[model samples]
Target: MTHQTTPTMLDTDVLIVGAGPVGMALALDLRYRGIRFSILDASDGTVVHPKVGTVGPRSMELFRRWGVAGRIRDAGWPGDHPLDIAWVTAVGGHEIHRLPFGTTDTRPPLPYTPEPEQVCPQHWLSPLLAREVGVHPEGPLRRECRVDGFRQDPDGVTAWATDLRTRERMTVRARYLVACDGASSSLRKAAGIPAPSRHATRVFRNILFRAPQLRRQLGARGALVHFLTQPPALRFPLRSMDGRELYRLTVAASGHAGNRDLDEDALAMVRAAIAFDTPLQIVSENVWYLTHRVARRFRSGRVLLAGDAAHTLSPSGGFGMNTGICDAADLGWKLAADLAGWAGPGLLDSYDTERRPVAERSLEEANVNLMRTMARELPKEILLNSEDGARARAELAKELERGGVRGEFEAPDVHFGFRYASDLVVGDGDSDSDSDGDGDGDWRTDAVPGGRAPHAWLDEGTSTLDLFGQGFRLLSFTDEPAAPPTALAALTTAFADRRVPLGTTRCHDASVAALYGKPHVLVRPDGHVAWRGTQLPADPGRLADTVRGAR
Candidate 1:
């Protein structure tokens, strides 16, 4: 797409291209920071296939922080729909392995967080975000506005975007430009950043259709996702979306008619998974390449990348969008700090340093999940069974047991246990200390140095996440008189004087204290702990400087 230069000039603090989930998330973060930004997308506001379904728990925590967790939770998914993931020979046939997670209604109360993940597919999610971000003809979120090219100077970035409707070109100048575009990010390619693939690419097809009565048809057999383990072609999920009215069937998109058309064979593969006679309307079919890749670099001068623009991974673990949400959170604060004039020169650089490794880890994990599924050996006997199917069923069950199918669904470690090793993290002397708090620890270290602050229940129906509003926070255990040592008093006062929003709280509860590890924990506006010490520093001014990116 070439740029058509025009006279109209638009200026904002930040300009975001591609209104995907990650882009919308960046806009939301910028809005919370009180920064002016404009978000644009090439397509009109409608999500047809809904590639992403389940939001991870950590992403849900961030959603809680952003004040949209409740709305997202209530986004029309049937409250009673079973969240269990079942692997079977067919949708209603020969069940192999099942991870019986309760429905949204019956889930046991979690100790770490008040908000668990919600199953709102991307189509439903996108509209909710669009409404919250103000989608209008001329608003910040301008649909059908395609970004063609951009140039960056030391001061700011000048982008050339075309209005698809009027065929008019407009220039947008902003302090920074973020590309939340997908894996085939033209913006990243335009900026000369290469996303080298780590694994061989494979093609997949996502078939979205409306099966309003399929839920009732399946009756007691209804599940959030049904992994079809049938033969050579059908072995992916037929997932329910929008309260069972809509469904998406994923299948391998190779060894058949090319991408130009969807062959009847593929449709038949889906039909075999549906055991009941139900009304079905084929909505949309999407053919996409699944890749395991990480960008050579995440930032280019005044331009930065987020979401699939920065990295692309297989969708096995469902970490693609959640990782991007984290990227948005990490970059949003640094941008706001830089614009507000308190961030250190090193602050912006940390974005790439901190997020790139996380993406790499996610890439590897997703690839592993993909391999586990792809490498499953389906014996000929299992595929072609006759009258006495007992032997075939026994063989299939044994394969499922050894395959560790449940690993795909229960991945709390991938979502919550990742830790960041950056210059910002003040490491304890031991190298093992970094991985100290893995799993459900009372006090697990935040993965990103300035990442999402750990979640802890502070009171009845309240979370420690609720404590962080739009500014920095300081948690000091009053029970420990020696905690925020007298030396750090000056630094605390300096933060107060700088007009940096800071919330100070003193907790005496043994559980909360044990979780925090240190007596004094200084959290950033975005809720990641910036500086934590068993005891306060001797020089409060230096502590303030360190927290303000002045190390």
Candidate 2:
């Protein structure tokens, strides 16, 4: 007699552990690349509470590429509503410094990227992204499915998961495995990856509530976020979760300086934060820890970590989720290339070399924003309605301006300015790219190698950003009557011979050419400039090798 074992198989090239925004974003990107994947979530496919408030511009650009930006943009957030961030004693209380960010409809068109920021919270965003990747049991996304464990060999990863509802066992064989299992990622732990804390971890309580009349009361005075400048552990953002009745108030659950505070009721906390006597109902509350931890490495063998699994940061600037989404975008293309048998020996290695540094930078920057709110002096009298109160408000406004608080609300460089410096990226002259924010602008656009290719409107309804993503794009600039150099014309054959999908776009616009800083620029599938030069290289295969991480 023989005991036979049958393993439930998945028709998947990549196995994704977790169906959070980061995992879903990776799925969406992989779907865009026409790759086969299976994404599993332990919990049901319902976003009961949302944490992330706003999606950054760069994330929007990637979402635009994935074909869900329109759905996100039109996902019921009022276009005429104010996008401002206001500091107040409460929602209807004394107004202090208000950063007058005009309504999305009224704000002047930005010169940088096509898609700007949107106020779509995670609860709404999660379903939208999940649907984009498909949610059926037979489809890529599997709701109520939990990945218990996985083992990665040199050739592939074998993940063991179970259907939570049925108590059924399953096996997923894949070329690669991505762990988006969140901050306390068990897979990351099982893989023995170290993500040491970069800053002191603090606990916070998010109180989700519905103030039905709060929107009416805050009508003209309504801002996206109301920073309650209360003293001690109470100072945090009371945000408009849905731009409507729904709102969330964040409070420090942990006592000041690590003291324990019992009897910290959620209702009492909400009342203390909101000065207005508006009708508000407590929906639910979730307590979470804000830790700054970046993994030493994003990849271990055939398994990779994305999102909170790779790095966890303070959400003061809303960079945590956006950073994770960008990680998915970066990894998706490389994973696709590897699966399609076109990836170079070192292509996948560049994922950590590029994204890990960005995570560290975002972590440090988010901490700065957190400290700005934490270390702020509340002056108990800022809430008073008297002359002393007015003076206190006026003084505090000046201090905030001098403190560079605007960096938290308007950080474009944090999103668009990171440059990949690895063996794959061919630097023209200097390794440094446009990373510093130039005062008013969140990011300065420059076409230096290793940076995001600068955006330009080639024609109405067409952007230069649309030129990349599918494959390696060569922006072969031709000076009107003069044709492309013979070497430039021959580059396509070299790339094709190596099975690298390379496309050429001849640009006559000198302004567009000037923004790129080089006559010919190679844009990677992730929309970053891989190489740039005055003319085509003598050996185009070497250029391909350099960009593809073969060399």
Candidate 3:
């Protein structure tokens, strides 16, 4: 497990470890910003079994910004396939409850966002992002490269890595290092960051199989997820993973009778969970521990953590990968700013300040979803095929309605509602600024400072979000030309004096103004409102410095 050599030196602007979706996302953002860096992944960039299934709406928005949303949407998951969630005794067993979310092609357009959620598995997503980051021998991405250790000094970090194929030792020096490594992050551990568990750890097994005829057999009754309700046998989700032949059956592996180890008794247990006589081909099986952990520190010195390295949560709400992608988007711009010689010292510090609390809230929300499934009351009579079984099933379906089952399926608030409360955010304490709730207004659609900039379609193809992510953009609501107001000339002057990148977009649309609720708004590169007001601030340079992390 050890390989040592007189490591040759390689210099770069950033060094990223573990090329999962998170790491590759950071690389993509960095590439978009034209930042020079090297990404190291231990595996050969092949996704054997994708654990993550659905890309959240917020992540889809980020992927849109990264210019990969089209590829993902066309990544072969059918657009007309049913996107419903069904609860049943087995694959072809007694029905209990169902939540019907219309298929992608049939879903209505929403005013909130242009990009909706897509069913892109990690296997499809990872290689796509890797290809975007480049897989050539001389390119930025290095496969089969493992990080052995690293040392951080005053200037940057020097990471020691081994090319697994050749056992060639190399040392990479970078101005900053981002750890997008997975839950058991070697970089996170090496940096001495504490990732304490938030709840009791639970064990589970995922049985990945191929039932080529199951879709044809079900016909119009097919669903995205089938929550198995067979009491004491299986109570986990049996999901249609690929919209085709592939499926994943999540089974509890602790005290249940279905708790057979994958290597020893997987086939028997998988067979017991299926009610149909269709031919089944077991592709793979793996055991995973579900642990909810959030690191106390997202940044330590020049080293920063993103994705599962920064936090880990239950895979219930499909929040794990999306959360990590957001982490990369948040960190990508900050890293670019610092390296481009425009970011202040405090700008890097705000990454943890902004992202950590969002991680905490997301963890709690996902845990609540997990508890809902765990606390469901399953009775034996519900599984019977008699008339009593019909009554019991109907009753349980009504109970599910009362129990708030839709919260698990439709949660846009969890994905897009978190507001950042940090030193970098500039609040409007003016008469229009409302602070009615937990003070900072954690979740709302008001275009409040530190919240996500509200989405609105300006033209046939463009969104209000399409205006952000290049640099600091000043959204001038007036129909006037793209010129700084006489009152705001000081802000423009201050930015120019410091060589900061800023732009002014003059929007005349009344609907956009209404959604923004401010005459002028300063948006960060990550598409969150940095500051908002009807007029320029009294101390524009001070506001500029604060937002860029100096104040």
lDDT of 2 by residue, 45-163 (tens): 77777898888999999998888889999888988888998988877788888999999899997889899999999888888887778777547788888888887787898888888
Candidate 1 collision pairs: 419-447, 420-447, 491-540
lDDT of 2 at 26: 92
- Stretches of candidate 2 off by over 4 Å are 1-7, 255-262, 430-443, 480-485
Model 2: weakest 10-residue lDDT segment is 434-443
Question: What TM-score does prediction 1 earn?
Answer: 0.93
User: What RMSD does model 2 have?
Assistant: 2.6
Residue pairs that clash (backbone atoms under 3 angstroms), model 2: 413-442
Question: How accurate locally, in lDDT, is each candidate?
Answer: 0.78, 0.85, 0.85
- For each of the candidates, give the backbone clash count: 3, 1, 0
Would you estimate the TM-scores of all the predictions? Answer: 0.93, 0.95, 0.95
In model 3, where do residues sit more than 4 Å from their true spots?
1-6, 255-264, 430-445, 479-484
